[model samples]
Target: MSEATEVKKVGQTPVSNSEAVKVANTSGTTPVDTSKSTDKKKKKKKKRTNISKIENYFPDGVYPEGEWMNYDQDFNLARTTDEEKRYLTRDLENQDHWNEVRKAAEIHRRVRKNVEGKIHPGMRLTEIADLIENTTRKYTDAEDLTKMDDPTSRGIGFPTGLSINDIAAHFTPNKGDKTILRYEDVMKVDFGVQVNGNIIDSAWTVSFDPQYDNLLTAVREATNTGIKEAGIDVRLTDIGEAIQEVMESYEVEINGDTYGVKPCRNLCGHNIGPWRIHGGKSVPIVKNGDITKMEEGEHFAIETFGSTGSGYVTTEGECSHYAVQDYDYDAPSLPSANKLLETINKSFGTLPFCRRYLDKIGEDEHEYALNYLVKQGYVQDYPPLVDIPGSYTAQYEHTILLHPNKKEIVSRGDDY
Candidate 1:
């Protein structure tokens, strides 16, 4: 995160420094004419400051460069060795996966930016969820999955998490859900798209009320701080500490009372690989003494979450997201469960998915098949993650590769 600017305008959240520069400049005074005039009186050198380009942070134009992260103060680092560093990188070096994940992340970000306006008060939650998923298809390989040169060229990797207000994550509206967006609501729209089994997982919060502005700002900064700590040699705990530090540095006020802001400790960044949304090592918002090294040639989504309530979040209500618990389990089962399992295994493998993706299932049988799979333990469920009710939460995420000497932020695009 660049420290060149500090004034963040209302509703002007930017995920990258390049974005910050544009927003900072755009939100400032009106543009002036740039006619090159040699007249001394009319000629004034307007000093232009371009913060360091994000690309130079990578080595060989692809990896992250950083000194070895310092060991945790509370935990001894003597057990960690060079072997542990290599233990973290698995199936991330392939260019195909890299390209696909980047595309998937960019597509999701593009869709979020496009459908943000549809999140206003009174909009049906189900309608908004349907729109985002459908729009994501229109923008990605799902646009022509059957006819594409490669079948894995595009499609959604996970269910769109349309969590709103007190709901933290994994809450896409169930069928015929009547929940509607309300005024002054804080909505966290978390979604993902996968290309050829490579997934790019990212999320953001859209809030219309100014009262929660500072809460959002804390999480955004915490995410940037974590991303800045991502590199080839940085320790996972170091990243966690930095994120928590940023998160706890602020206090948010709602209705004349101040609430101590903290990162949602239960939610943290994780290493992601092909179809592996939660892989490698866990990077918690608060340091928990997990001494894992961030290795070169690994892709990690550094997630930062700030909250106005308890940092701890728990499962609630029915789950919309699920994944095959064991791909090799082929025990005999009812025809409905078996059929659903077959489709899931063939289409999604081990990736987390939602009931909405089973759009082809006969409407009457969808519920029965899903219940059978869940009851049989063949499918794992992902319920909504929530803090105590009335709490406010915000999250920002970015996917990156740690190069030997530098790092590449793969998910940021021209519009970010």
Candidate 2:
């Protein structure tokens, strides 16, 4: 989760420094006369559009009084052209849906920017998780989980994943866990934000040492390659081949040993649906024979992982990520398990949750109930997806919305 210095509007040019100064002067401060300024040549400022004012899109702020719908007439009017409007109204069928998706993506971008450069070697993993989750709660206005039953409730889509070193994904700090980041560790920060179940899943790798720069670059470029290759009717296999070509081409050397970056063959990005993180289709990192074509009006998380060891991951360590199974099944016999299931349905629905979230909502001493639900096939437990032990891994991900007219990289930022 990296970010740019200033937030830019979608399909709009960035505000220049002079325009920024003009904005800063509106706060009851005397404006500086640019006529007396040093520069001889004056550049004309581009006309600002309503779309550039992100605040207009969220007129009532991040939290709405009722449903999280944008009632602003300018919301639809802000489109750059009539074709863009048709893409939203006719093709997508709902302008507010895409608006919510963009809002959720913006929340992710802002939170990631706030937390960047704050993670250091000595911070506890729990501290880092809390920092990220709390910031997300503040931005989404869903701080109170007990009151998250609103139709357009906005909050974390899943637990904050702080997977480190060989662990590629699905690892979060459980309650009382005391793991600390070290100077040489390569940590992957993965998180999601959801507005009315439109989840924006994005991630990036961080390392204090410079030796892993190539590793980070390979995975990041691979992710961007996938994004660039993805389109309305693009075959999934071609995108994977393009990703692998960029990712596997780079090699990293550490301690007099060179390791060719390998795409994690077992892990692949997937399509995302409402309240569903992994929606049916898989976007592979390496070239495969799967002939899935990315459809218009579909959302996807195009993530890539580069590993120094085997280009595969296995489930290991403590399980923290959990989601209610989508299939229908018989209810558990245990009353506690039934209660836990009820809670999960009420608070998270089909979205993922962690043990730490359960504790946050005052579910104390409920391990047995949680385990019972999992054993009864009422829930799915996701353990840490790790590569070979002692081998380093890096990951980069971005969420894409495939519109009929154009593909929007919703989770994109300056710092990939």
Candidate 3:
């Protein structure tokens, strides 16, 4: 897709997906190969990544898609009002879908850690990317794991955040790209994968600097606070507020300049579901809107993150992907759009919109095809930054299931 057509997010423009990638790649600081004098030091200090065992981590009784055998009233507070209860019931079904997603995410995280510590700086980005993809291939439920091999296939997108010191995020190193890792530079590895339509969202920064320990500590604390304070019947804003409060407490001075931290405006956490990669509601780690209530049986990725720079963010980048759905020309599909249901079914099969597939279709039929695809749960849009400066971003996320009696965190530290 061209950059011009991508501007219209959700039927917004002319920027193509390819144009967005070009713009994002060129906009970031030029990648510079650095020295590895500290390589041995890192080798000695790097901790082994011990991912949790699948059987022990995900017990048999722990079913995904929010099927809790027991529901407590305290946890059911979100459904207090009769109307609210009805709404909560529907949300619970959505939560059930998320439960599966949470499991998928947990598995992805484990897969990542299985090789994370062993991968050293100075390795070709493509090499590491291939390894990550291969790890996923062994376990993914997707019919086509081969798509992941292609950087543009959307099978499993690669890392863009941890390229080097000057580079920030959204980088997919091609086989010909001459970029290599370095020791002095901290690497941020971020990946997302789906299982049975459930999405796993996560990112990690691997740094050699001792100060990184502090950064990790602060970020983990802020993230935990956001999770601890979040609950059913709770507002969404509270999650961000919790993150903000924790971050503010640790505000520090760098190079004689006083600076507080904030999450890159572009990196807010999101809601996920059976058919949705990034759901309708966005949960910001920093306060922005009303507090979103937490409901029992709801599934979510509570990611608490902040950066050392200005919290403001902007993306002029073209839309690289769009969640296309089959819709009739008779009515719009955005707000309470149920009238277009039949059109969607007739137009596309039960699959979400994926840009790779759309590029092959004709322009006249593209819209209908996308609409139908999205409606069928085959397509989902992924917007890419075009001609926008990249920023340093960090995140700590865990796919979780909210239980009335106990909260189930899918991604736990490895016991082995």
Pairs in clash, predicted candidate 2: none
Question: Residue 278 lDDT in model 1?
Answer: 85
Question: What are the clashing pairs of model 1?
Answer: 63-403, 63-406, 63-407, 64-402, 64-403, 64-405, 64-406, 64-407, 65-405, 65-406
What is the overall TM-score of model 3 with all chains considered together?
A: 0.59
lDDT of each: 0.70, 0.84, 0.52
TM-score of the candidate numbered 1? 0.74
In the range 1-416, model 3's lDDT, one tens digit per residue, is 01224243586667554555556567587643322443445567666544333445556725343223222336454445565555545556666555556556556656766775767756776677666755664545332432433222223422233333323344445335556766544455666666555566666666665544544556667776766666667678867877877866665443345445555555556666554545666777777786667766666777755565565544433232444343445544453234333332332233233333333222323455445545656445444332223333345666566655445565544521
Better structure of 2 and 3 per TM-score: 2
**TM-score for all predictions?**
0.74, 0.80, 0.59
For all candidates, the clash counts are 10, 0, 52
Judge candidate 3 against the unseen true structure and give its global Cα lDDT, from 0 to 1: 0.52
- Give the number of the best model, judged by TM-score: 2
- RMSD vs true structure, all candidates: 14.3, 14.9, 16.5
lDDT of 3 at 16: 55
Pick by lDDT: 2 or 3, better one: 2
